[model samples]
Target: MPVVFRFFSVFPLWLLHVMGAAMGWVVFAVSPVYRKRLVENARRAGYRFGEVRAAVGHAGRMVAELPRLWLGAPLPSRMTGEACVEQAYAAGRGIVFLTPHQGCFELSAQVAARRWSAARGPITVLYRPARQAWLASVMETARNRPGMLAVPTTLSGVRQMIKALRRGEAVGLLPDQVPPDGQGVWSPFFGRDAYTMTLAVRLAQQTGAAVVLARCERLPWGRGFVTHFEPLPVPLDERLESAVLQINQAMEHLIRQCPQQYLWGYARYKQPRAEAAAGVTE
Candidate 1:
C-alpha cells in the first residue's frame, strides 16, 4: 500500500482528479447504500440532487489526491479572507480552526501550518487513526509535518492541543465529524438530529482561543485549492448545548458555499461508537 501511495504521489494533479472522478462514479453506481445515503444527506440539507451531484466525483477526487497531498511537493494554493486570520493572531489569543468535511480539508490544515506556524506556532490537529495499520502508519507520517502536529483522538492528544492553544498556537479539527458516544451531544445538523462533537466549543471556551471557520475550495482542472478563513458568524454561547448547535449551523453555512465539494456520503447521522475508556483523560 505504501508503495502504491508513493507511485501515485508522482502523478499530475489533473490526471489524478480525472481518475478520481471516475472512481467516484464507479462507487456510486455499485454501492446502493452509499448512493442512498449521499442523496438523502444532500436533500435533507436543502440541496437538490442536481446541486450536489458533483460531490460524488469530488469524493473520489479527495481520495485520489491524498497521495500527492501527503507525499508530493506542496501544490499551488492561495488564501482568501486571510485578514480574519491576521486579526485573530493580532488579538494575541490562541486560534481554533473549525473546518467542515468540505473541499480539501487535509490541505486546509497544511496551508494554515505553512502560512502561520513560523510566526505563531504549529497548528495541532485532532485526527482519528485509520483502522488499517498500514494506512494509519502512512497517515501519521504524512500529517506530522514541520508546522503541523497531528494528534490522535485520545486523552493525551487532547491535552497536547490544550497546551498548544494556551501558548497562543493554532489547532484545527473537523467540527462535522461525529464523536464517540460520550464525547458528543445530539444537535440539529441540516434540520436533522446528528451527533456533534463538542470539542471545538470546549477548546475555544477553555483556552479563550479565537474560533475561526475555514474551508478549502478545489479549483477546476486541478489548479490547486483556495483556502478561505473567516470568523464565526456569531459569538459562541457559554452553554455547551447551544454552542454545539451553533458550530453545526456554522458548518452548514460553510458547506452551502460549495455544496459540490462537501462529503455528502459520510455517515453523519449514524450512531457513534461507545467511547473507549483509555481515550478519555478526564
Candidate 2:
C-alpha cells in the first residue's frame, strides 16, 4: 500500500490533479452534510450563497491540487506573492506560522520551505498522525521533505518543534486541529465554542517567535498560487483560551480575504475531545 502511494506521488502532476478533482466532486455529490457545512461557514464568513458556491468551486481547485501537495510538487520559484517571513528571520526571531484550513495550505508550506531553505532556516509543520494505521505509512512517506519537518501533534512532537524554534527555525501548525484530551480548550470561533489547539499559542509564547498568519490563495485558471504573510499579534500568556481566540481571529481575517478556499466541511465547533472518556469502544 505504501508502494502504491509512492507510485501515485511520482505520477505526473497533471494526472494527480485530475484524480483529486474527481474525488472532490464525488464528495460534493454524495455528501450533503459537507455542502451544508460549507454553506453555514460561508454565511458565518459573511459570504452569500452565490459566493459560497464560488468558494466551493475554488475548494474544488484546491482538491485537484491536493495530490501534488502529497507528491512533493516543486516549490514555485517566481513567488510573485508577498510571503513576508524573511524580515522576521533576519531579526533572529524564529517564526510561528498559524495557518487555518484555508486555501492551498500545502502550497503555503512548500513555498515557505523552498524560499527559506537557502537561508539555512528550516520550517516545521505540526500534523496529527493518521488514525488509520495504513494511512500513517502513506502520509509519513509523502510529507517528510527537505527543509520541511513534519511534527506530530504529540507531547514529544511539541518538544521537537520548540527545540527547532529555539534554534531560530520556523515552526508551523494548523491551529484548527482538534487536539486530544487535556490538550485543548473550547474557544469561540465564528460565534460558537470550537475545540481549539493550544500548541500554536504555547509555541509562540515559549519561544518569543514572531507569530504570523500565512496562506496560499489560488489564482484563476491554472495560473498557480499566491502565498501571503502578515504579522499577527501574539498573546504570549500561560492562559491558553485567550491565546486560542486571538489565533482564530487572525486566521478568520485571512479566510475572509479568500472565502472560496476556506474549508467548510470541518466540524470546527465539535464538542471538546473526550479521548479518555470514550475509550476503546470499537
Candidate 3:
C-alpha cells in the first residue's frame, strides 16, 4: 500500500484529479447503497440531486489527492479570511478549529499547521486509527507532519487536545463525524436528528479556546486548495445540547458554502459502535 501511494504521489495533481473523478462516477454507478445514501443525505439537506451531484466526484478527488498531500512535496495553497485567524491568535487563548467532511479537510490542518505552528504551537488533531493494520501504519507516517500532531479518538487523545488548547495552541476536529455512543449527543443536523460530537463545544467552553470554522475549497484542475477561516457565527449556549445544536448549525452553514464539495455519502446518521459505550469522557 505504501509503495502504491508513493508511486501515485509522483503523479501530476491534475492527472490524479482526472482519475479520481472517473473513479467517483464508477463507484456511484456500481454501488446502489452508496448512491442511495448520497442522494438521500443531500435531499434531506434540501439540495436537489442535480445541485450536489458534483460531490460524487469531489469525494473521489478527496481520496485521490491524499498521496500528493501527504507524501509528495507541498502543493500550491493559500488561506483566506486571515483576520479571523489573526483575531483568534491575538486573544492569546487556545483555538478549536471545527471543519466538516467537506473539500480537502485533510489539507486544512496542514495549511494551518504550516502557517502558524512556529508562532503558536503544533495543532493537535483528533483522528480515528484505520481498522486495517497496514493502512493504520501508513496513516501514522503520512499524518505526522512537521507542524501537526495526530491523536487517536480516545480519552487520552482528548486529554492531549485539552492540553494543547490550554497551552494556547490549536486543535482541529470534524464535529459532524458521529462519535462513540457515549461520546456524543443526539442533535438536529440539517433538519434531521444526527448524533453529534460535543467535544468541540466542550473544549472551547472549558479552556476559553476560540472556536474557528474552517473549510478547504478544492480548486479546479488540481490548482491546489484554499482554506477559509471564520469565527463561529453564533455564541454557544450555556447548555450542552443547545451548544451541540449550534455547532451543527454552524457546520450546515459551512457545507452550504460549497455543497458540491461536501461528502454527502458519508453515513453521518449511523449509530456508533458499542465498544466505547462505557465511561466515555467529555
Please name the candidate that would achieve the greatest lDDT relative to the true structure.
1
Per-residue lDDT for 67-161 in model 3, tens only? 88889989789999878888888889899999999999989999999999999999999899999998899888888899999999887888899
User: In order, what lDDT does every prediction score?
Assistant: 0.93, 0.72, 0.91
Q: Give me the runs in candidate 1 sitting further than 4 Å from their true place.
A: 277-282
Backbone clashes, each candidate: 0, 1, 0
Candidate 1 vs candidate 3: the lDDT winner is 1
| lDDT of candidate 1 over 152-217, digit per residue (tens) | 999889999989988999999999998988888899999999998888888898888999999999
Model 3 segments more than 4 A misplaced: 277-282
Whole-model alpha-carbon lDDT for candidate 3: 0.91
So what's the TM-score on candidate 1? 0.98
Query: Which model, 1 or 2, shows the larger lDDT?
Result: 1
Q: Which has the higher TM-score value, candidate number 1 or candidate number 2?
A: 1
Clashing pairs in 3: none
Q: Which consecutive 10 residues in model 3 have the weakest lDDT in total?
A: 273-282
